[model samples]
Target: MDDLTCDVAIIGAGTAGLAAERSARSNGATTLLIDETFGGTTCASVGCMPSKLLIAAADAAYGVRHAAVFGIGATATIDGAAVMRRVRNERDKFVAGVEDSIAKIPDAVKICARAKFTGATTLELSDGRTVHAKAVVIATGSAPMIPETFDAVKDRVLTNETIFDLATLPGSVGVIGAGPLGLELAQALVRLGVETMVFDKGNAVAALKDSHVADALHAILEKELPVVLGVETQVVPDGDGVRLSWSGESSGERHFEYLLVATGRPPRLEGLGLETTGLALDDHGTPTYTRETMQCGDAPVFLAGDADHDRPVLHEASSEGTIAGRNAASFPDVTAAERMVPFSIMFTEPNVAVIGVVPEDGAADVVVGTASYTDQGRAKVMACNAGLVRFYADAADGCLTGATMAGPGVEHSAHLIAWAIQSGWTATETLALPFYHPTFEEGLKPALLAICHAVHAKPPPFRDDGFLPGT
Candidate 1:
């Protein structure tokens, strides 16, 4: 059997793994990257990019169908085959770009094999090889979690991982789960002329912690598709399709050509022989690791990306990978690094975004400023007047702490808020920034003004300049 040794060995060559390799090598540590399949990331392969492609297609169809609102009469005829073709074709180009990056890595440092932990610092490969490293990083990523109850209808069930493979849209789809993934796909499918319904046991959408924001998003999505929440849902096979029955707050039975499950994705740790690692693992089979340093307990082992389950987004994975890799390279003297502020965006129409710290409801010393798009100037002009946004700040200092919103162009607005929070800007300071007229960003002015008022820092009246009275 072949044996290899390296200063750092990383398992799973996904986003986090690749970043780890780059970081480790930059630290002057000999590194090796191993994966069963190379040149693919969850985002490029199935998660983010492809889903956005489908959403883009859906948006086109929706715009065409709703052109009457602009006094333009138009008909939208969706060709499901053509839509799928572009999604797959564009998705391939993205995957190829990632593969090209992988190709640039040195051949001697890349291994195409599944790795299982034989010890804290040793791995046995699927290709009958052994790897011993001074330090190890687990970036194995995650896979969809399918309930055993749905096993009976497995043939007709689809998850994000497999849904993109469809040659044409299904006649109808029953989506189980009302989180971001489910709602995003459900809206896209419905817009693309497929009858789609979403079911969730919880009364939430897009995983928004702020009930106000969640409710607004839920209502907006319901206008597009039947999003049934706060119900117990069951699925069973029905001829060539699947049948879904729900009980509790709402009771109903429906049959669709396929079932789409967006429940959640647990880390792919089942076959990695984690039991042999001698690390303290949680019930989810994930090793306990320090977030700042990505170190697992006191050992020279690290966990990053979806494997750590800290933050599953691509940027967070890249950051955590860099942390894990740097710490792994400097093992026995690892140092912690500062992490970025939390930020997440869902690509649903009137995009949903949650940034920084979401203050608890009615928390002391917390003030909230809200804006509704129903009457916002730009939204009214665009006929996209639907959804709401709320900003939270410390009442004592008016420091922008967090924001939750479901509104037109929120994907862009959320970034501005995140940057402001990270820069330690107060509501009044942010309000001093220029806001052009007839733009979605102008919608933020009212919310900032409200925060200034709430904190007794309202701008002086009759100021010729639009800037708020502040330092």
Candidate 2:
């Protein structure tokens, strides 16, 4: 209705915010998109994409060391600066390329300056501008949760955010927390001749997908890096090298030249003037939203990303952002929901990729099939490789429910598994599908053969094409 008015105002121009903008606009509403910055932590800077490029360099470095294993007799020196250069070059190319995430939407999505709530329906901008929308969405995402004890050690300590900014890699580093980020960075360092130590407070590699997959991943990591598990570290300063004073069954303190904190994450809603809005944040300042609407109890407001806490992930944030934006435009009734396949990856020594109905929170009765790289034809040809592929299915129907792999090119396979699970495809249906031979895709076939075993317990009758039975 006015220059400063719109049908929807979406905050945080990251994945979620951008997705929301597109969704709202497509539904025939003018939208204004605002963010303190674009792409937040995950996409633009230290998030998955750039980190992946770094991982690729780390892999190449590994190849240089193992060239003889590949039948090439040459020694190569790892150049850390060169690797960073490759990262910058790739990052530049990505930015120069068309960004589909922020490009081409139905309605006018204006980028506003640093925005904060001035009223229930109003936002104040950094440049003394004010905008009003029928509904507001906050998708501001998460930041690295630095532990209190580790504050003084930041000179020698770094978050995952700053680890990539190193011109020269550390000779030895202690990475706390064996989550995806920790493992990923550990592999990067270890591959580059850094004597890296990874510390997971738990069993060091309790994979979110399934324990079987975690075991395979553990085998892979054991060969590549030194790991300390089930020990809590009280991180403090100790000379040039920082000391991690830890005690458990084994009570002792260990020291490292550099310490990386990968404990967990807190919601990133600070400095946006939340105090002015009077919205509720948990003790950690994260917004509370129901799993259903993902809306705060406050009127005309929606939340997404790490802030929302349904699932703190890039894809999850993108999906939630879109839904929030669309609902903001619709206002009274929103049809969107948060159903996630949540394909996750850990770029460790033996990289892991997973998608499925995970084995947490009493999700029982899974029909699973396991295939390893050593057993698969493609893996033998790959020259130097190790890992496994496992698919989980509903035992009753043999419908493939989930899949996890810690093998080469598992990211691509995760997509396929996610599709199969979401489509409710039975294992037999997967078997009927022609998979190319001498490729990782064929590994799915053996998985189907195993699925036949599960079906035979009370086997389904064979079809005309000899499908569905255990024959």
Judged by lDDT, which candidate is best?
Answer: 1
Off by over 4 Å in 2: 1-3, 38-41, 96-113, 124-130, 204-209, 249-255, 271-285, 290-294, 337-340, 360-364, 457-471
lDDT of 1: 0.90
User: Please, what are the lDDT tens digits per residue for candidate 2 over residues 136-160?
Assistant: 8887777788877777887988786
lDDT, candidates in the order shown: 0.90, 0.72
Residue-level lDDT of model 1, residues 1-471, one tens digit each, is 779999999998999999999999999999999999895999998999999999999999999999999999999999999999999999999999999999999999999999999999999999999999999999999999999989999999999999999999999999988988998899999999999999988988877889998988888888888988899878888998998999988999989999999999999888888888889998777899888999999999999999987789999999999999999999988998988888989889889888888988999989999988877777888888888999999999889999998999999988999999999999888877766777888777778888888998855353122533210
lDDT of 2 at 93: 62
In candidate 1, how many Å is residue 304 off? 1.1
C-alpha lDDT (0 to 100) for residue 94 of candidate 1: 96
